[model samples]
Target: MSIQMEDCLLSYKTALMAVGAAAAYYIIRWFLWQLTVGDYDRKYVFVTGCDSGFGKLLAKRLDSLGFHVFAGCLTEKGVTDLQTGSSGRFKAILLDVTKSEDIAMAVKIVKENIPPGTGLWSLVNNAGISGPLGFPDCFTRKHYEQVLDVNMYGVIDMTNAFLPLLREANGRIINVASVLGRISIRTCIPYTISKHAVEAYSDGLRRSLRSQKVSVHILEPGLFKTELFNLDLIMKNIYKDFDAAPAETQEYYGRKCLKDFTWVVKLMGFASSQFHKVVNSHVHAITAKYPKYRYLVGYDAHCYFWPLMYLPEWISDFCLDIEFVPPAGAQKKKNN
Candidate 1:
């Protein structure tokens, strides 16, 4: 072979070797990650938002794994749904995470149910609200508070209330954030803000609680086909916010424009139907001998949003803005 051809062949061989090494490393890592703490009998798990979605699924999954599950539901119907045809090990607690009284009552209930001297193995803070969808300027303080109450404050309160129990068991605390937490978008302003708070809180918590042998894990899941992602419900919220805006603001962004924007949002249907990925992350956080501090669930979360977060702000902003259709009567369009 000519010298140039020989060098090219060597480069290819070196690249192949590097690729092989990476594959081998990941294969070994996967096996190591499979190590789990297997005593399910004495372990008890508590999950919030069992009314539907991930909370309900996780509670049921843990119950199936033979752990006593304390499923917290906001409504009587939620409680009933989880209890009906479920294993006796599943204890449904009427919990409204936003209410201090309800949280206190839940603490009592969890304590009463778990065996004395045994601590809770996991406390999954899965309750969250999508909040009202609107342009950032359209939202009032109340709109932000409503989401923060459940998504941020609720997580804090639950973690604090359950810390003692978790410490006793050297347990895990799993808080559900979102891919939007890492990167902000024009939509779901309140929800994104709350999740960012969750990410911060979880990190601070993990570091502070290290001495106590309590681990905190944050789950950053992309949009999923959950009740929170219901398009009709989202549209209703958007309309409500739009109507509530000032007349001048309404005129600036006409209803037709708003509708078109929402239509664009609908077209970008990135919500994954595979709910198991999130549930599996929760399970690993709870049962693994060593769990990741942050679990980025779903391809959108792992491959898209997470990577976007690490890019330059201008670049990320450009990429995210591609999906955003300018509303009717936008000043920029008028200028154009």
Candidate 2:
């Protein structure tokens, strides 16, 4: 009878231990969630490229969550839309990312608008350009330079201009990079190169700011439905410039290249989203107490692309090719 009683006592103790462990896990999980979501009250954030896409949606989300949002757009129409749609929480400012003068004006506005001691809490470097799409060999020096000016140098100038404010507030810098930054694909060399540069810049900045309490985060989103994939615009531009090609260039690729290219471009448009996933990742990175250094946003980003980042370049290329077919009726060319 005593042995049976002792066995019961052991079972009771095991049950109590299991309950304690489960409770501890719950508490830890709650703490982590809180840490990641952060406090949304009274914080201020600045976002660029508010004209459309992720920037517009992110600005709205942040403003709705009670953040003071300073949204920058390149055009008057964008400014009007943001001002009209949002409550008094958002202030739309005109900013052409490539223009230093516009950048200066934006900085001045931020200094004047944000109350003294409030500082500029976060700078979302969401402004970027996806330059002309074609084979890497097809791109000219001018095209590469133009893309770098807007995508790479523009980011650098903005960050430098706003560094003082960010330092004062001990806030975060969220750069909207791309999965292309981590993995290069065919026919997107200019954009891929620029994004790769951005990744390096963000990493260097993160390490440099470690001692200063400033956090740097990168938002690496896969494909999303946006004006970037406007089929009509792409075809119009390509056709308009087709005659400008050298005689040799025309002979090499032939007319079928353009048709196939358009098909693939249209396919990408259908595959991506009208509603971008980058906005959620951007908000979390900006507001979270301990924001992760890098966030891979989009369904395919985490599921497919990111894992391939670890593979050899040839393997990655093979994997990407299988997933994305070349434009219809365009055969793979033989090496010279």
Candidate 3:
């Protein structure tokens, strides 16, 4: 009986030791993580797409909080707006996201601007384009090429060019990927594909930078009230392009297709809101002591869309089809 008791005691002690070791390991890890990423007062942040939307708002917010903000815009008008709106705290640079020379110039400017010791604290890849939305079949090769060039290649080029500055500061890199990256929709195939590629690239970058103490974060935002979906702009483009389509193209799809497209556009406009959920999440990720790997911003992003990310592909497709189908009584009438 004594021998059995000794054996039992030994097993209990071993289990206790294991638990204690695990607890100690976690405590040390948490402490180190906290120490590595804490505080951001006077750090420099470089952000792209500062002309409008989340990028513009985040740049303004960070600048107001005393961070040196380098705002990259594509147009002269955007540069003017950022310069006039943000006082002297934010420096606006004309950066065409698709241009390699522009990205190189931006990196050069950053290297020259910061003093010898100070380094880039955060590099936010927020510049993106929402390409022409329709059935995937409708998109030409040129459309896919254009979208990928702006969304995926542009991000890779910028990151590769500015990696030195990011490493010097042990900075965090934030890429604005969308929920569409996780869950693909019927339309917006090119945009969706580009976002998925961004997620993969960001993940690889995070792994690569782990040893260097540089963190990478991906921001997945839901639909928001941005100029990307401006009704006037969309209508203008649609009419301009519709007129240029082959004469038979309009005869087949007819006015009904146009109406259906318009309805979809209006639905998107209604669903989108002006809330700053995405920008707020961006700020938190950039400024937090312990930044999370992925941030799902906006109500629909976290609530409606992200949950579907775990569903089976077939099931998810069926659900999406049901959600997007026109009403039962609204079917198009056959022409006699």
Candidate 4:
């Protein structure tokens, strides 16, 4: 064989050996982790936004595992619903994270219910909203405020309120960010901004509180089937924004442009609907002896967004080039 061919053959063999070693290491590690479970019965966990999605499922999962669960819900109905699923060691508290008074009330309730000797063991901040679905021009200040209040400020507000309890026990805080946090897309500016803030906040908190022994974590999941990604609901929201726009504004953006934008959501139709990945990840983060700093759920999260986040801006944009909007003339013609 020529020198070039020999070099290529050697490189291929080295790659194969590396892949085999990685596979073996991961397989063994998975089994080893399965044997490790934290002391659940003695731990108290507070989960926010337990009305639905990840919060509801995680609360139920943890409760089943024998952790004392204090679930926070926004409505009486949510509280009642969560209560029905759990009994004894579980108590549902009405909490609106945006309201300091409500958070204070929740703190009082949790303090009253927790086991006498143990402080809080874990807090899962899963409440979030995608906000208005349209271009930056299509939204108002209120639209941005509504999302940031819940998605960004809500987590910060709750963390501050619960830090004392966390410190008392050397606890863990799990913040649910998104793949969008890693890669800011053209769509949903407010949601992206809020998640990015969450990423920054969680990282800062993790380092700042390292000495205090508080392990902060982030959950960055790609598209999943949840109320946040409900198709009919999102379509209705887009229509409302479109109809509310001024006549001149509508003419400028055009109907075809709106349809083109709406169709982009279908890209997530293939996204994993099985939310168990989130539950499992959260469970490990809460129970594992050494949990990861960031638990990335879903293929798109690790395979696409994770690597894209490390790439140069030009390269990242190149990957997203296929999704780029049509040229001006083409869009105008389509509108006509």
Per-residue lDDT, model 2, residue 298, is 82
Model 1, 1-336: lDDT tens digits are: 799999999999999999999999999889878999998967989999999999999888898898989999999999999999788788998999989999899889888888788998999999998887778779999999999999999999999999988988889999999888888888778989999999999999999999889889999999898888788888887888888899888887887778777886685466788899999999999998878888988888888888898899999989988866575567656799
Which regions of candidate 2 are displaced past 4 Å? 1-33, 36-41, 240-242, 274-276, 322-336
Instruction: Give TM per candidate.
Output: 0.91, 0.84, 0.81, 0.87
Report the number of clashing residue pairs per model. Answer: 1, 1, 0, 0
Task: State the lDDT of candidate 2 residue by residue for 1-336, as single tens digits.
Answer: 699999999999999999999999989866764674345556778899899999999998998888889999989999999999687878999998899999999999988888787777899998888777764445679888988887788888999999888888888899888999998877678888999999999999999998987889998888887777676776675655554667666556667766666566666765467364677778778877767789888877888888899988788878877644443224435322
Clashing pairs in 2: 225-273
Candidate 4, residues 63-98: lDDT per residue as tens digits?
999999999988899889988958588988888889
Which window of 10 residues has the lowest lDDT sum in candidate 1?
A: 323-332
TM-score of model number 3? 0.81
Candidate 3 residue-wise lDDT, 1-336, digit = tens: 699999999999999999999999999766754543434455889999888988888888888887888999989998888889675657899998899899989998888878776789999999999876764445678878998998899899988888888888888899989999888887578889999999999999999999998899999988887877777776665655555566566555556666666666667777567547888778877877787799887788878798788888887778777635442224444332
Relative to the true structure, candidate 1 reaches a TM of 0.91
Q: Please give the RMSD of candidate 2 to the true structure.
A: 5.4
Instruction: Supply the global lDDT for candidate 1.
Output: 0.89
